[model samples]
Target: MLKYIMQLYKSKRLKVKHAFSSRQGGVSQPPYDSLNLAYHVGDRRDDVVKNHKLFAYEAGFDFKKLVFMNQIHSNKVHVVDEDSFLVPSCDALVTNLCDTPLMVMSADCAPVLFYDEVSKTVAAAHVGRKGAFGNIVKNVLDVMWERFGAEAENIVVAVGPNIKLCCYEVGEKEKSEAKNLGYGFALSGAHLDIDAIIAHQLQKEGVLKEHVEFLPHCTCCESERFFSYRAQGETGRNAAVIVLEDYV
Candidate 1:
């Protein structure tokens, strides 16, 4: 049995079961080349399903209880308060529901996880250039605070691997757009730092600086290890997921 090597989340304060999947260790073949957790991509349905079961088994969560997002690259956020498998048609999934795992998929895009230990709430969002400029982080935070009592200062965030500025080149118009959005530092000539913009958004919304942690992995440069749509054009997607520790 090929085991999925998980990047399990470790937090001293947040009681949640969370893990980020990489591109290695699974049953998929060729372009997917094993461990592609998304069904929307061109990977075989059976392969994606097998990968999900393996991921759940390796990560110690019930695949049957997971909640997935139908990401649309918009700032729309849906709140989950029940244990169900229905995928929400939104870019972000916010939930205070225990044992109900939330998932967001990505390929050369940022996958972010949020946790509020004080309110025992958790969220997952898929962000690319569109979501980055749309302020998806603020939308997630707003939903968290309004529906659940999650405060910005109490939210702990983790931004997973994505295509960094070193490889995420944009046109002159997009570069100027980023500069006008108060992200001049995200500009390196024609490239934009997508993750940096996301981190800045988190802090701008009152999330504590110490609570934000983003991995330094660049999917485009590390495409051989992690799927990158920007590099491969057509590729499998990696998944970032989170769930409250207590199950109903």
Candidate 2:
């Protein structure tokens, strides 16, 4: 009975399974209450494992085949395969292997999923402010193209929920830094529109506008459904996951 935000990118050439998990429909406690997919955020290990099992069951993937990153807010991209089961220290993960899920855990930071129909590859990225400033999105695209023979034009991206500009307020230093990175700031230099920044990055990398899908929910604003670290201080992490299904 677990609910997920599912996005199926389908074309005549290929199809990819992508899902963004909400804070609902699992067993945990207040703050980490229900469906918390991350273990490092102080959530009990047993609860996290059970939650993953539920998520895997609902999302139609094996929990044992899932690979997660120890996200360090860097631009590092790990090019993985079925044999690359060990968790690595990176912000993004790309793989062409079927049924092996690449997952990114995030609270307020953006969880971006990528799929190239032509190459039948999938990627998941943890794009926080630091990661975005480090150009993680472009790095992921580069890995996809160079390692998996993925074309920019054939890539479809899904930007999952995060802290939008409506509630994401920032100080001058952060705003100035983002501006220095050539990204514009909003709310008169108080808020940063991270989704817009990532979209611009994808476009700059030659990803088509029509192929990029942005989930419009703000994690901080919608605390009832999504866990927001920015709002809750010590919060559990939500996940964005993608897997290439076996071609039939």
Q: What is the lDDT of residue 185 in candidate 2?
A: 41
Q: How does each model score on TM-score?
A: 0.92, 0.92
RMSD of candidates 1 onward, in order:
2.4, 3.2
* Per-residue C-alpha lDDT of model 2 across residues 125-226, encoded as one tens digit per residue: 999999888889999999999998999999988888889989888898898888788887433558788888888889999999888887878999998788
**CA deviation > 4 Å runs, candidate 1:** 1-15, 83-85
Residues 48-88, candidate 1: write the lDDT tens digits. Answer: 99989888887778889888977888989988865544665
Alpha-carbon lDDT of model 2? 0.85
lDDT of every model, 2 decimals: 0.84, 0.85
Off by over 4 Å in 2: 1-15, 185-187
